[model samples]
Target: MTYGEFWVHYLRAHQRTGTRALHYTGSVLALALVAAAAISGDWWLLPAAVVVGYGLAWIGHFAVEGNRPATFGHPVWSLVSDYRMLLLWLTGRLGPHLVRAAEER
Candidate 1:
């Protein structure tokens, strides 16, 4: 599917507010961990960050969303979409995107 199409699918997979909240938490923590790893010169924190990030997101998918993560099929797209969703959310623009995704459904 096209990038635009995948975005809708991505949003649909993250419809629940709690699911997205977990994702946003994971994303923020992951970035902080990465920064810590860089500033401290402890590269091992990089892997830990990945684990923390994906771990929380996986929990959301399985326990909260009751669905598989988009990462399994489209890793690159999923990663990019994760940040896109986060930025839109930070700017309070995510509501429109969510509405658009729901409309497509």
Candidate 2:
């Protein structure tokens, strides 16, 4: 799917508050790992970021959303959308996206 289309579906998949929280937590942890890697010169933290971030997100998709992750088909776009979603959430602009997704559903 195109980025726009995928974004809509991604928002829908993350409708649950718990799922969003988990994603936010995971994204933050990923960022922290990257920073730690840079500071400590431990390159392993880079892979850890991917694992921790995607691991939490997948858990939300499976246990909370009961759906497959968008990453399955669009890995790059899914990663981009994950940061976009996290940014929106951090800026308190996610409600409108969620509303739009729900309307489409």
TM-score per model over all chains: 0.98, 0.95
Question: Tens digits of per-residue lDDT for model 1 on 16-105?
Answer: 999999999999999999999999999999999999999999999999999999999999999999999999999999999999999998
Candidate 2 lDDT by residue in tens digits, 1-105: 578888998898888988888888898999999999999999999999999999999999999988898889989988898899999988999899999988997
Clashing residue pairs in candidate 1 are none
**Residue 51's C-alpha lDDT in candidate 2?**
96
Native-structure RMSD, model 2: 0.9
Question: Which regions in candidate 2 have their CA more than 4 angstroms from the true location?
Answer: none
The per-prediction CA RMSD against the true structure, in angstroms, equals: 0.5, 0.9
Model 2's TM-score against the true structure: 0.95
Instruction: Evaluate all candidate structures by whole-model CA lDDT and list the values in order.
Output: 0.96, 0.91
Distance (Å) between predicted and true CA of 77, model 2?
1.1
